[model samples]
Target: MKASLLKEEFKTNKYDEMLKDLYEDASLVDYQKDRYANALDKFIELYGDENVSIYSAAGRSEISGNHTDHQHGCVLAGSINLDAIGVVARQDDVINVVSDSFNIAPIHLNDLDKKDEEEGTSEGLIRGVVSKLKELGYNIGGFKAFITSDVLVGAGLSSSAAFETIIGTIIDGLYNDMSIDMVTIAKVGQYAENVYFGKPCGLMDQCACAVGGLISIDFKDTEHPVVNHVDVDFSKYDHSLCIVDTKGSHADLTDAYGAIPAEMKDVAHYFGKEFLREVDEKEFFDHLADVRDAVKNDREILRAIHFFKENARVPQIVEALNNDDFDLFKKLIKESGNSSYKFLQNVYADFDYKHQAVSAGLALSEIVLGDHGVSRVHGGGFAGTIQAFVENDFVPEYKKEIEKLFGEGSCHVLKVRKLGGCKVVEE
Candidate 1:
């Protein structure tokens, strides 16, 4: 169907069934329809009413194992319903993308080499994904797309990863056989971020956004991570997952995020290894004094300890979830938050004590939920959002209270989506 025809169908309620199938939330059907309609309108405005396909890639939440993925550690992550959506139509040789945010990016697929001038832009991600796909012996080509996202910027949700995955999905659906696994798409996204975007991020964000649902991922082998889907029925427990955006800026925090892996690797270098995961916990503890002396950073030593303990906690949390032990899971979550605050020391930048939103949010959540729920510093953690597992019935009250501190609509109730990066509309 053409873009114009799709718009007509949307107005006539011809696509409501499809939307229901895609979202699985009857309550969101109208909202999803409106979002798609708006994207289609924008596409028609920019690229004309050519026949286009729609694609979606979900944003991710780091459920557990904070800042451990870069060191080949274990983590539990989930894909939230928030996502990036694209309306795309195949083109001859050039890929043109106009997003709701930022200027238009046009990339020539034939000349898909890293451009120094394109670093830190969406064009870099597009070219990187294309280059990676071609290198992996997969099909690649050009397409014109209108992209938009609900993933909040700088809120710890993996928005960049979601956008990268959206690109990968568009390419897979349009040119390739659409047979590339989500994990491969995620790796391509990570490649884009690391080499093209100039960020030394781990595979966790991409994997979580790409794999979808609640998953237990062990990155012991970076090339082939072991991914297991954990069956968690949130409705059964009467709990809701909420993310509170504290409106903290991530500006000038690159060094803070980068230092985590750097210092952990420094400790590993002290023990003749590459990552903290390779060093045994007992050996690290036994040589703690020597390691501290060699590294000469007490914070680094504490971070290493956090990594080991946090890694150990992943499986226990998974086990508790598998056994339907919400209490134990909540307990481990609190412990993880405490470890992140005390040992990892990423709650706030040392210099910015005046703006401690994460600390204040955690403290408030503890007071509000008491022994009924769990809250923690979410994602990269220096500044952004906090994750809270709240009782379903108490959600409204919790959202109301939190919003009072962070302003209106700061609290978002999220669901774990089952699908990752994929083409939502085939026609």
Candidate 2:
């Protein structure tokens, strides 16, 4: 559809159903309508009014299985209402992208090879996704995209994953008949991040962002992960899902994040396996002494232990939520949090103990929620934010108390979005 027609479509009830499905909040329909309208106008103003399509890829929250995805373990994650949205028009030769912050330079389609200079830049992610799609024998093309996102960056919400998914989705919708599945789109996103964007990331964030809804993912086969949806409306449990950002600096913490999966793999290597998931739990426990000695790091052994327990807990939590057992679900969440804090040991970086903002956030969450709610280290941990399941009635108070320590507007109450990366329609 033309950008002008799409902007007019938003002025009526044309897109209400689609907006409702994506956001799951009736109250947010108008806001999304305005968001799409504003983005369309910007697209027209920047690239002229050509035929364009709208796309949205959700940001994700890790509900269970902290730091477990890299080891081919299971995890439970959800696509949040926060997302990266794009108004894109198909172009013939070169890809150009402009976001609210800055403009990515035009990327020539013929030059899809990984460029060392483009590392860690949006240009790299675009070229990388295109390159991976071509490598996988999928169709590739060019587009001019006006992108925007509400997903808080560096707040453990997987903003980068959302961006990557959006880019892949736009290409899929435009060139590949939208035939690429979400998992493949996710893998493309991960490839872009890992090889092109210069970040070592597991598939969990991209998978969740691309797949949508609350899902349990088993990565025992990294190339072909098993994803299953856990059908339940958590809002009905009378709890609000809140992610409290601690405003902590993630600078110079790549090594800290890298150490976790490396150490877990170290334990796996001792057992002549590549990932801890391949090792039997009983064998690990029986040969603890030898394994510990071989790894030469007690922390590595402890982290491996955490990987096993946390992996098992993902399915248990999924079952609990499926059975409508919110109480048991909450209990399991606390257990996951405890395991991550003690055994996984990613609550705070050892190098900077004095600035333990994540630790402080978790401590404050414990104090505020006490028994009624549950809080845990969110996402990659070591820094950033913490996730909390706060009782609905107490959300205002909970948000106030937590934001008092972090800052006002630091607490974000989010909803699980149903749709992942897809082209929006007006029907």
Note each model's CA RMSD in angstroms: 1.5, 1.6
Give the worst 10-residue stretch by lDDT in candidate 2: 418-427
Model 1, residue 60: distance off in Å is 0.3
lDDT of 1: 0.90
lDDT of 2 by residue, 274-387 (tens): 999999999999999998778789999889999999999999999999999999999999999999999999999999999999899999899999877999999998889999
Residue-level error in angstroms, candidate 2, position 384:
0.2
Local distance difference test scores for all models: 0.90, 0.91
For model 2, what is the C-alpha lDDT against the true structure? 0.91
- Give per-residue CA lDDT, model 1, range 185-279, as digits (tens): 99999999999888778899898888888899999999999999998875577787899999888898888888999999999999899999999
* Candidate 1: segments with Cα more than 4 A from true spot: 17-24
